[model samples]
Target: MKARTRTNLWFQLALVLTLGTLMAWGPAVPVQAQDVVVKVGNIIPLSGPSASVGLQGKQAREMAVEEINAAGGIQSLGGAKLVMLYADSESKPEKGVAEAERLINTEKVHVLTGCWNSAVTYPVTAVAERYGIPFIVPVSVADKITEQGFKNVFRIAAKDSWWTRDQFAFLKDLQEEFGTKVSKLAFVYENGDWGKGFAEQWKKLAAEQGYEVVLDEPYPSTATDLSPVVQKIRRARPDVLMLVSNAADAILLTNTLAEYKVNLKAVITSGGGHADPSFLKAAGENARYLFDIVEWETDINKPGAQEANAKYKAKYGQNLTGEAVDAYLAMYVLADALERAGSLDPAKIREALAATNYRSGPGMIVGYDAVEFDETGQNEHASLVMVQINDLGQGLERITVWPKGARRAGYTPVFPMPAR
Candidate 1:
């Protein structure tokens, strides 16, 4: 009886030891499986004239979401992964509104981001307001976008007026460096919200800058041949030619310049045409020496830029463009805001978005360095960059950083024409 009792005691002790060891080192306690999903909605032009821009943005947003998920997602949100739902706005206002509604109502997305065109952005913003969803504008440059005073809407991109002011400053620098006077300048723009808005801002800034506007013309977006307009510009012979159009129209005008040999000292393009890679591909040698106002630069290769480039190429088999960078950074901003807000509630996200501050690609720490918004929700510290279309026609070299006296000062005219 004593031997049996001793044996039983030994077996119980060994079993207890084994169980305790298993409890200590076994399978991580299964981690209570977090919800692990943060939903984001996108509205962009997927099939219209701006399709390429929209496509780039879509790919970048997706890439950012994937990367966030791979890194275990928002650490502050219990490791919740991001899920994105995209809607095609087709560059139309009504479609944008419908898509915005669908994204908020059907998909139940926690956040909204995208809409390449400002016109599309404006309508979609109304939907976001109605649904109480937080909308972040990535590439739309319309000045009134944030000026609408929608609390839920935040813009990470610079407004048109901001770009106009920066471009004028660069022009002044160009004039001073080259001694090439731009007393009379011609502004040509397409008949869209973006074009119209830029033209008005350009006129306002030109007046303030003491430049004479020789010609201010608005053409239909679908205008195929720019020969007539080119002839008109040639007749006026403005010292500088400023073009505001998409890639296609830009190409048309460039062709006209090549065909007619319009005598202009300097040609500048709005951010829309200049920032797109397709313009270089389409215009080739004609694109050389042209200047553009750009928001993002791939060559700048600041912190997080190379990683973004490589990841973007790996996923899309192409390099990042301004459109792609904007969307990618926008996603990062959204993620940061969500994580900081600690909840997917749209209102909280809006508050957090207003408070967003993080380092993004191209060496820019967005929402940092004084990202306070005015009563109009416009980011007061927004800045712009001047980029020159180089001889290679493949990339835009940074000319200057805006608001003056930054680390990278404005450019001196490298190929300034002799004064007439």
Candidate 2:
């Protein structure tokens, strides 16, 4: 009887052990999937004066996200999908801050991008830094945005100083080519961060270059008529006219110039004015003979650039705007950083981004190698290109690259200065 009882006890113990082992490593039980979603945020002006440009950026970003996801997602992170959330800042700084807060606190995005205007971008970047999110600035040109010394913020586009420097270099080349002195210059800009920042840079550079700035005018962004400003420029009668306005105001100024027949030897604009295709459509023939300093070219379809351009055209059913190109490049940069990091952790992504030095989509070779941050988190070596809007209103033709002596010399001027 004792032997039999011992045998039963052993059998019960073995059965319990077997059941526990099965429960611990059972085929019926499911394993949880790894977290494979990267959240990115965007703050852009979707329903404001700069909406035309902002919309293009928003579309480009969405397209890039879709493409990246379609290609088996992010391969470096076990095929993780990129999720994007966007907020319309309405081109207002205050609204940008609020949206940025929402994106950070509520949405809990890992990275932040977008904001077309410098005014909106400037404030939104601050919020991004406050929350320790990596912010990639695509289109804002204010020097201070990068100069603020935030380690988490990176801008792919040129600053205001760079733009002015490029513009001055182009002007010098034009002066040498035409044998005409660009001594007396007139400056007209909107009364905003972009306008003020660029205008100040131009003024300082003009002084350094020994060019005489005859007249300087700052108009309201909401100004209905630019006739008074046009008249002021006409009266100044400077050798060259430099306009710094957003697309809508740019249209207004151009229309005024055409209607009033303000004949000047040369009309040049900073990037914002004539960079968008809407400028050509709005100004029509008036846009002829106007020169603009731009960051990207519609032509010169380099390998990757051509592919991006084709994709943009296919998706939008029209040519991609400059802002769109920047947005696309921004996504490409983020993707490269994520791949290099091999993880989605914000700190790791930031480290990888600082080490990024790859060719962007097209028209850009990012110098992310040693992207050491100044106190303001701005990349010190950012550059700009000088693009001349041709009479045909197609892609901006490359006239000069920034940092003196880097221009394509002896190219025939597509939009030459009117006979003086």
Candidate 3:
């Protein structure tokens, strides 16, 4: 009985000391909350043909993540810091799949993003879905990525259907505005999911618009020599050439077309390679008067666009392309969702993302107003803008022209492009 009394007395003293410490500190902070880290896995092509755009995406994500962390991180979860893990897909579907599995099962990443090539993203989405991890696609414009009915897939860019629709609309508007009739249309594109999806829509749109299809050509983007393709384009003798190409191929096709002097009324391009900064330097005069559709341009008149572009240019030594802008905005979107989620659970984060209606922030530099997603995980507010590559005394810059309302002030588009 005496030994039991002594043990009870010691326990009482220890409890009193613990209460005293708690009172001194006012309240106890949960160590888990204060030290929580959100791990994000990113899979992008760091090498291979698409490396330029992939590097841009990586740089953009780094910049945004730095800004987010510096601004006190996710406030909702006791200031949890976001941790990023990167995997290079090498622009291969198999590589993307392996990386996704490793990131999900081994790296234990809470969320996943990327595999910029639609072909790569397509297979990686299945890996992510199998594991139930949230997959965020910034710029893979394939419509079927979201059409898979997977709950965890969310895309931030306009799908191929939307892009194709806008391209046709711009074409029609150009003809109407300048009183120049465009009848024969040639479709030349890379033979990939993205290009084929676009070509399919282009065919239907061409038929609906009552334009004759002069040439339908699908070439591999990796083709080193495009003289043969240019010859085919020249032989087709189409009034307008509608092209979908990647960076190297875009430069190749542009220069080759110039070398062969394949004169046409206009050259409308999908933004993938044509909007790349290197396209301007490599294609030079050849890329002039080319109209490309994109999500954002350096000259956009949005609130924070100039500042953001200035910062990105200062850091990366180049301007941001439509693909890079989506990546930059994506980081901001993830941060916003994390703040609302207040938990590291992927489901919570996905729910917050689905409910996201991000309108204003540093990342609102996009051409659109908001970043709200539709039921199918597609950003409904996302839209495309057409920009003409011309020298406005600024030494050949991309100037917004289509959608008339979004066109730059005091500038007129040169229709029926001048001959070289």
Highest-scoring model, lDDT: 3
Q: Is candidate 1 or candidate 2 better by lDDT?
A: 1
What C-alpha lDDT values do all the predictions have? Answer: 0.75, 0.75, 0.89
Summarize candidate 2's per-residue lDDT along 73-168 as a digit string, tens digits. 777778888898889989999999999898888988889897889998888877877878899988787778887768788887667677777677
Query: Better model by TM-score, 1 or 2?
Result: 1
**lDDT score, candidate 3:** 0.89
Off by over 4 Å in 1: 1-33, 45-51, 90-95, 173-199, 214-239, 244-265, 271-287, 295-297, 359-373, 392-415, 418-420
What is the clash tally of candidate 3?
0
Candidate 1 vs candidate 3: which has greater TM-score? Answer: 3
List the candidates' TM-scores in order. 0.70, 0.68, 0.74
Give the C-alpha lDDT of model 2: 0.75
Q: Give the CA lDDT, 0 to 100, for residue 85 in model 3.
A: 92
Query: Which ranking of candidates, highest lDDT first?
Result: 3, 1, 2
Candidates in order: C-alpha RMSD to true structure: 11.7, 9.2, 7.4
Show the lowest summed lDDT stretch of 10 residues, model 2: 365-374
